[model samples]
Target: MVSTSTTGVLVLLGAPLGNPEDASPRLRTELARADVIAAEDTRRLRRLLSELEVVPGAVITSYFEANEAGKTTALLERLHDGKRVAIITDGGMPSVSDPGFRLVKAAVDAGIPITCAPGASAVTTALALSGMPCDRFCFEGFAPRKDGERRRLFTELAEEKRTMVFFESPRRVTDTLRAMAAVFGDDRPAALCRELTKTHEEVRRGGLAALAEGAEADPPRGEITLVVSGWTGPAASEATPEAMAAAVAALEATGTDRKIAMKTVALRFGVSRRDVYEAVLKAD
Candidate 1:
């Protein structure tokens, strides 16, 4: 039972990554005025509310990864009822590797209006602090967890020319760095940004090998963001056929399927599979 003329607005709020002080005044006003607030972590939202000294008149509900799909439908219902709905995550903007993408997509398809209260983001924060080339960069989100998967991912990105940013668990950071070193090269410049925008914030900068060794010697704890300088070596298009064959052999040595390795080499060299196959034939 909803009125067609009373379609509600969906507000996407950007929560502060760590410091409560980073919360914007507009965010506070929106939180207080919202009719329903869907939060990634209700407890964290409460803490934020307490910190902001705002007593929300809205009904707050949990909307995290596990429950996002099931809860989007109910939230959409509220929107149809013309309720001002707000979605906030534990940190940064919702839907950027966060839980709000489903809801946002649903709202869009349902013809509901959507707005955002932009705030601090760890991605840009880490990138800005890294001192790398930020004119052009790509956020790769969190790197794959499995060893082979992680290595393959780094291998694929080996020829990426733009600066890259990634989020990683402190527990796997050292291993991840080692893998990056193996593929991206030991001397590849990178920055390990830990506990960004908070007390005890630290940014370690150097070659991948040094960073990996430092991380191994003293394990870092807290939220971790890694900023890496992209491929500065010779372009893949300029690579010789022998070089392509050697690259494929290197991957094959690491237990990658022969076909998959060939495909990866072809991709890295910006050549077709047939070209790579011919290179392999010449090498043999």
Candidate 2:
């Protein structure tokens, strides 16, 4: 049994994305020594513990999205009592688009010490396998489910210079790719990483349009992560008024609303919407 501190520490455990061997030694030790274990899925946690061959003596409780808000206070009470509380998710680190954010924030407000056992993350794994520039990147947890919202998001990120990573459902991957192709341009380079670190893991590299087509032909299964190359177009400052107007006109020709087309062009070119509007007027 590990010694406990006077003030309990919140240990954020990183569950392996898929492979059990990827679990860190420190994570194993923490699992065995925790006073209480809060898991996103108790069944999954059981499978993991069985795989790791570690018998945890801690009191295990389910801490998932639905009950996270209600359970945080009770967990905080345990922490105040100096019990080592470990938070584990289905995969990857807790609180990264997961259920632990609320508890983490509550613990922070309560002045509890927090630490983590870092392990395999799909974000970095897919990013590494993507063959895109990794020096700079952003993780957009999951694309919006709604068509309009998702398109708007892609439009806003159209000019992002950093490589982008996104988690997407298998069913929506193809559609999401098509939406991305529409806003980020058909020729933009991208990679689709599916079932990462698992037996049937696969990575498909191509332009957004090609990816969409391939996915439509043969739907991918398991968890999906997308890595898209950032915009490499001329800087917004270098964009001439004529160029902005032409871009908006192109979108408008595709049946996009005039105002919305102007906004999309502005975002794609990294210019003010007003500038795109003025350019359109001058072109007319």
Candidate 3:
């Protein structure tokens, strides 16, 4: 366990993803109070400090996912030495879909004082901007990059009653939007937020199909966040093999090749691709 008298406290500060205005004053105070600053991207941290109009000269080090496992120990050593260690991610909250989780856990286990400098969050931003149910929600970060893995992941959240928020690469936003449309239905309301808080920022609210169609026609080029309305539960008798086969064939018709399309459909059905494929062949 860390000696609190020596270790002091470790603060997890959230940095603004884009807009400098999103940086809370609390974050500024925390950043200034730290003896050492561990940033996900030291260069980005430099940029943020520049924007915040404060020049930080503390001992700064990188702590991203690539080296977080190793860096955790190094940072912990600083904390154990009675230094104030403040950790910051590039955006939102540290460890919220970022790489600060390990360091936070280590500090907690060692009895080091830990606190958060709450600031911007794409999940909450998109949810409120989406006009979806905000009382309860889940943040799924980024969906799996591979199409097959994405299926099983989304399947687990198929019946989630709370609103869902996801982060996606701008390059794959169209494809991901279409996937959401297929599973959640073309008419399920969703919102696509691009370049949030920037000059060209846009938030388009509509059903999944419309967002997918628009994004496909003119792809967006910026950070993308999505807020999807939750399933009210698979409406009566919808989780059937016939429904499964239909989703697959329909996706296939929409220029989706058999393999990737089949996997996505299987997720909607909560079944096996082999089962879905057999049903597909039988239907034919």
What Cα-based lDDT does every candidate model obtain? 0.89, 0.89, 0.81
Tens digits of lDDT, candidate 3, 1-284: 86337656789887776899988998888777788999988998988888887756569999998899999998999988988899988788888889889988999899888988888877787777888899998889999888756655665666677889999988889888877776666777889988777789889989988998999888888888999988774443665667777887767654567886677666555667898788888778
RMSD of 3: 4.2
Model 2, 18-79: lDDT tens per residue?
A: 88989999999999999999999999999999999999999999999999999999999999
Clashing pairs in 2: none
Q: Whose TM-score is higher: candidate 2's or candidate 3's?
A: 2
Could you report the Cα RMSD, in angstroms, for every candidate shown?
4.4, 4.1, 4.2
Q: How many collisions per candidate? A: 0, 0, 1
- In candidate 3, stretches whose alpha carbon ends up further than 4 angstroms from where it belongs are 1-4, 233-245, 251-283
Error of model 2, residue 115, in angstroms: 1.0
Predicted candidate 1 versus true structure: per-residue lDDT over 1-284, tens digit per residue: 76558889999999998999999999999999999999999999999999999999999999999999999999999999999999999999999988999999999999999999999899999999999999999999999999789877887898899999999999999988987875665578999999988898999999998999999999999999999999775466556888778777766665667787777766655678898899999999
On a 0 to 1 TM-score scale, where does candidate 2 land against the true structure? 0.86
Work out the TM-score per prediction: 0.84, 0.86, 0.83
